[model samples]
Target: MRSLKILLLSSAFNGLTQRAWLDLRQAGHDPSVVLFTDEITVCRQVEASGADLVICPFLKDRVPEQLWNHPQRPVVIIHPGIVGDRGASALDWAITRQVNRWGVTALQAVEEMDAGPIWSTCEFYMPADVRKSELYNGPVSDAAIVCIRDVVEKFATGFVPVPLDYTQPGVIGRLQPNMTQADRTFSWFDCAAFIKRSIDAADGQPGVLASLLGGQYYLYDAHLDSRQGTPGETLAVQDDAVLVAAGDHSLWIGSLKRKAQAGQETFKLPARHVLAEQLAGVPVLDSSIAQQRFNALAYQPIRYRETDHVGELTFEFYNGAMSTEQCQRLVAALRWAKARDTQVLLIKGGRGSFSNGVHLNVIQAAKVPGLEAWANIQAIDDVCQELLTARQLVISGLTGSAGAGGVMLALAADIVLAREGIVLNPHYKTMGLYGSEYWTYSLPRAAGSEVAHKLTEECLPISAVQAMEYAMVQDIGPRCPHTFDLWLSQQAQSALTNPQYRDARARKAMLDIQQIERCREHELAQMQLDMVQNRQQFAEKCRNFVFKRKTCQTPQRLIAPWALTYEAGMPESRMLNG
Candidate 1:
């Protein structure tokens, strides 16, 4: 197919949009992203892009008439629904109703929203139990890709889209309302399956509203329990999960989204922490005794799975933030896995996060912010050091995004592999942190001195493809995050069995020894000096960022550098966030 000029418009450059943009670019098409910043700016930006087509992967807003009805282009919207499915809550309805089948539709952008002409459609089977976000990001994302490619390929052949007709036969989908709290209201009188369905529908957002112990909280991250108990009664505490009554059955509450009360900021925290006072009187089951009970599906912070002499360790921290406690736990996990008899080990992070460096939220919440920041950095350094010195072949696999120290820590592995479209922010200047994850040793060694300096000073976000070019990563996996795990396993397993890899291990060990001897201790000592002397400023910045809930905006220097003086009124323009 010939290369076409494509314009992508979305509320944010989220996972779906990133994947579609990268895929289209690799297929020899030019694609540019547009954030709905303002009406006038966006209109001027789109017209300047000279786009032959427009694709909205996960856009919530409708396109304007001037651009949607371009005289020389086509506008397409990739809807997360099946053919004839017209609504915003298609996935939510499927989960709550426990539908066995689901799908995605690619439709032309006409005035009447999803009622527009269908370009392509793809369907997939669904399991009986799954979360709303998990189903959307996994199977739903896969189907959307298939439909998008089909539509794009057909359009390249000069094919016009067919209009939607309700009279047509073999249509199963119908319009549905947006899933709201009213749709998810259930009490102890409901059956176990009913409770689970309600929770699934609101698992990712606007969780089911309920009250316990005279306080109202939104419950999320639910796991079904096989044990039965009386309705509305407290059961037991399993790790961070809280077991609560669900009619005759039970379910584990992994986290709670508390409402703002008494002029306090509303935030989500672990169930155990949020309900500490009330749960103190609840029965606490012994580990061995709890083992005898029916299967309990509580949250697993760290999990290890082995296949063909390769062990994969996955650490799914919430929002990719690694608190000081979380860092220490991951260190212990890495040490235990290293002592095992496996020939190769894979460090797999979460779907939405690998590690975004240290947890700013936890740091700001600490009693002494400076002391907590100091301890957190050291804990992560120990984790990186362990992976750097492991005897087995260590592979750091980033299934999600990584930033700051998180990006440097992943470099500890002998081979760093990332899923396609994964964003990496290797700089820490935004948080007023010089950073201390042994970056001084790992970064320059990986990408050379020139690129390392530029990366830190520029504060630019690099894509997976650019990381490969800069020698910062070994390989890039599937464009779709859903297919990354399978592709990574195939590559790593094959790499382990190669005879040449066995001989290369000796060289790797020697280099590791040399790095420790020359750079590790020296860099860490300097970090201590920098952080200790700048304690007050560091503390204030972190507190401001966390309490104010600020996001990292693209640095103006990156777009209009002071080094270059442009003509007046001709400002340098760029994307919303680099």
Candidate 2:
């Protein structure tokens, strides 16, 4: 293949976009990104970018007629649907309608949205129990990458795309209307399965709206329960999640966004916290003794299990945001897991995200936002300390994208293995904080001090492969979740007898505690100024993120120059626009 000059124009540099950018670069092609700000600006950027082709991996904004019709270059749109599928809610409809098969299509940009002729299409069996966000980041993203690679190859070969034909076989998809709030509305009287599907379809965005505790709230992070209870009643509360009865069975809800009242900002929080007053008398189920107690809830966000010589610890927080209490609980879990007889400890994250650092929503919702923010960061630091000073060989398995302090927390482990196609944003400059997770010690040790400085200052998102090159990760695992699990197990079991593991464990034991503590102290001092003093407007950033405010203009850092230089090759930050 030739090294084509490609431009990635996206609404935001999200996970899929970052993956596309990395794949293109790894394939020896020059790729740059231009964030979609407005119609005029997008057109201007596209015209100015000297590229042979342009791809919109996750664009929400429509391409302008001028750029789409330009004869000098070709513009392709990566749609999350199969042939003949047209609409913004393609995946949402697939989940809610319980479609068995779904696909991703790469089509030429035209006047009509998602109605262009298809260049390449790839399909997969739709997963039933997965959340909408997980589906997008997983199967949908995998298929889109396939379509994208195919489109790029076909473009290089001067191949023409097939037009949409209703009579053609496998063309089962059709135009789906944009999913509205009404489409996602579910009553407590609805069956558990129906309610779970409704809520799953709308996860990560506008959640399913329902009445709870005599108030209206948007529900998210749904999980089915086996126990039955009276419809519309709160059954129990555990791990900040509330188990409630539905029409047929019961389900667990992890988070809720209360309906905004006059002059109030609506943001998602732990379900129990949202209804703290209303559910004050509700029983809090003890997960440690759930099996012993009849009718006990079995919800566990942080789970630990042993397999032979490996102790696997999985922490799947909602949207990868760890609240203060959650962090404290995880610290205890880590201590317990470290005491196991296993030779290697594997720390795994959720499918949707590994960890995105402190819970901004929880902090913003607190009575004293700054103090809460301080506490949250401090709590997360303890998690890092546990990993850094672990007695056994520790391996951090990143199955999803991570950012900010989350990346630092992963680095605290002896060996970091990331799933292929995952992105890691290892800087905190975008969030306007110096950041602390003992990053000052771990980052420099993993990656050299010079690269660490460059990464922090540049605020660029690196792909898993790039992370490996910078020594941020020891290896890259498979993209598929099941396959990665197998690979993680094999690797963990092999690490017990590997000389590298023994050497790494010895190095960890010999690490100077005094120096690590000093680094944490210095980092926390800077963090205190950033969080407690609010010197860099972290509160404003948090509010903007929680409110989903759109950026009017692309930051100078994200805008690719007309002349691509070697220094400007890295992918831009995706969370900056958040």
Candidate 3:
């Protein structure tokens, strides 16, 4: 690839530009970034970047003509909009119009604002049902990366730019300026289309301002219903869903925020509830509402400490929904447990979900930094393996849904105890990633190769009873009668006091055999990599098979014996607390 000089004009406040610059550098281009802000803060940032810093008068219209015509290399301006759409608030306009498809484009900078010739564009489709906040944070941000990657790839290949045809139908659109207060006020007489569009356009960044009986509220997520009722009249209330009347139709206001004396308080209401009856007469709340809002936003992190036991340690794998900070905490806890002499380690999740797997947010956030996210995953894997290899028993108490990485965490346990309603699912294939956390070996051992293969390939949710019947779980204990804490206490006591357990352990020499089996399993995992591309592909194949069988009536297929025996030498039952 031929190296070329590149100048990146961006906002100091924009994270997208920083990410684009990193991508360009990784692609072997000599890229320099300049913040397009009049503030001194932006100047300092540009200077710190060790790039040529030039101060321009206006962000939209004042690109230095000389720099744009630079002879040494091309000057490309990254516009956070799709081809044919230009100017500020382009995204906001698209959202207001409920446009299903939008994108970001990198174009050659020119004298006119947003009038540059497009170099490359990356397009993405927004879900029709998505809220405005979701559209901005999810698809819009992702589209930026997509566009940047395309631009960099084109640059690397010595590709020539094609000029866009302005005369082509549906190929030109002007920009809209930032929204004003008047633009956001909600009108009760507006049509369903207008109301829905208004709600979508107002999203979180520029929220909708609605006058209630006496105070103001911001509508976040809402739907339009044609059912007629008196405007602003309450209909009914269902958990977390609210229905209110518009002029000609009823509007389902799923979530909302009220402007408080201090700030805003997002209150989730029940569906079909009468908004006028419940909140119309009430005066705007002051300090009490503010306290409630604060309390609502505060969330406590789950923390588990290892107790003094040879075989017992606590194992907790983050569900894919976890944030980077949460994953960091989990890794730290695992390291602490590994260093200790816990005999039987119990793996559990606090909520209804054992784990969803690795946090996709972290992955998306790390795209700008390239492989840094994978490095974090590797760290998590190391911590997980430490638990798997511990001399003590590794027990998994799966009380609810365990999907993707969550399933791998349960598989890592020597014994898995699942509640009656617990579900085991592998969901990686649909999202275009592999299953990590050593599930490739751990799964086959727990349920046999046929079941493991089917679980991954079919991507079906296996019930707790089915799991136990298939040997995925050691036992399906008492149904709905006992809570997880109660079950754990009973199991721990049984392991600590049962003389039969001790006697059998001494006679069978299980520990030595378990150590040998774990080694063989690790070796098998190494060998599987030669057959499969990565842990993700192996996981994806397994998930595809499972999803394919979701509607089948036959008993779920299992993995072959060779695959099961490949890791069967590993111990299934060991007393962790003893």
Candidate 4:
């Protein structure tokens, strides 16, 4: 490879270009910078760094006529958007379209914006919780850095431009032409797939808009309900959830923005409140009145339906608050079922919830003196190990919300079944408790570390479809009017009679594997102790903070652990007071 001089053109400060220039210089190459902006920032910075500088107009529209004429050995443009999605407001355009994946392309400068052949591309998947600004500020910035590195590597090896493989199928050609004002207007009747795609594309950018109470609101995450209701009628609010009616389906507005007198602010209100307010005086339109409709929908009883299938057992979890005793009872029942040659276990919650998991408030309040906490954790770990090692195919039938411990329990199952509207949340971090019960291993194994980290660390909700995509859920089914009973019947038949069912034999093998690899008694006990101590300290800190009191002085023995765990590398003032 022959080294050559490199020049970069960018309108705004390009972190990639700057970093690449530094890397090139470190590697003994001559690199220069130019700005398309009218300001002298790039020129001054380039001159100060002993590099050449050039001024040009914007690179997107005038690149062919104006900017590409530069004589630099290899003139490169760092496109902030994905290669196929290059254009002005590329990031904005992508967000408006709800694209799940995006990339940055380092291409040779051509007359048209982003028309040059690609040198290299780096891509990243967008998370649902990531805001529009974050996509540009984080992933987009990271993309620029990647492009810069590619450009620098190309310059080191003698600049050879490679054209984009347009002949390849699925290569998006041509930029998105600017949209008219009319084209930007929001439409509620769009097909579910299109709406979902558009929402994902626009994620963390801008462009998705909806009219709510005469104010324009940017739509973030939304769900389509096939159940029809009056268009624009408010349905119900459950805490921060807002339900609204659309043409063909009801739209559950998980989050919303309203214009405040001061400025635009987002509100996290329940869908029920919005629904009641909007439809207060209107005649109840649906065949089922909202009260009866909602109640009829909320609590549906489930019965255990036995099947002869080797890997299928169908049972329903009753609708009610979760208790530790109930969890223990369920575990015992599963053990009994396992002893009876049950190979496939399907546990579904009644109505709108699978299980809320362990009650956080209860766990927090339980003064599990250090030793007891460890003992409890060990017991929980045993249950988790049993679930993992069960000979039968263990599946969670999730019909409603599964939160925190509930999600972990579902994860313990080999497979999970969910209705489309089920919501899964890991609410541990928010409550300041160190997550335990083997979820640390089970969650990452089920979903990739990146996703698991986001769920555990940020306390984000995972929808059933998203969960399915992440391998968190295996099957998605619709609720039968007779409830999941009929569904269970079919599932049981499939499990008991299916010639291919391997769950019984599989369970024995899994148990043997667990005995060898996931010994539940030893490590789990210690982990539980650690979790309990951490939670106790965390609760103390939170209580102190709430009461405007300082944290209690740490005992000298405890100080060592505190420094090792939470206070390492902190200054004296920031360290725990002893």
Clashing pairs in 2: none
Model 3, which residues run further than 4 Å from truth? 2-75, 124-126, 156-165, 168-170, 177-186, 191-193, 224-228, 235-242, 252-578
Of 1 and 2, which scores higher on TM-score? 2
Best-to-worst order by lDDT is 2, 1, 3, 4
Better of 1 and 2 by lDDT: 2
Per-candidate clashes come to: 0, 0, 49, 38
Residue 434 of model 4: what lDDT?
61
lDDT at position 498, candidate 2: 71
Candidate 4 lands at a TM-score of 0.39
Candidate 3 lDDT at 151 equals 66
Cα lDDT of candidate 2 equals: 0.85
What digit string (tens of lDDT, one per residue) describes model 4 on residues 306-337? 54653333322322234343345456655655
| Reference-based lDDT, each prediction | 0.73, 0.85, 0.53, 0.51
lDDT of 2 by residue, 3-51 (tens): 8878888988788988888788788886788888887667656665567
Q: Provide the global lDDT of candidate 4 against the true structure.
A: 0.51
List runs of model 1 lying over 4 Å from the truth. Answer: 189-193, 261-265, 281-298, 305-312, 341-343, 350-353, 360-375, 397-405, 417-436, 443-507, 512-578
How far is 419's C-alpha from truth in model 4 (Å)? 21
Off by over 4 Å in 2: 261-264, 288-298, 500-503, 563-578
Model 3, range 243-308, lDDT digits (tens) per residue? 567888876564455555666333322221225366544333222111222231112123344445
Q: 260-346 in candidate 1: lDDT tens per residue?
A: 688787555567767888888787754221133322243456777778788788777766777776788788878878887998888
Candidate 3: global Cα-lDDT?
0.53
Which stretches in model 4 have alpha-carbon errors above 4 Å?
1-85, 88-104, 108-117, 121-159, 162-183, 187-201, 213-216, 225-229, 235-254, 259-342, 345-392, 395-433, 437-578
Q: List the candidates ranked by TM-score, beginning with the highest.
A: 2, 1, 3, 4
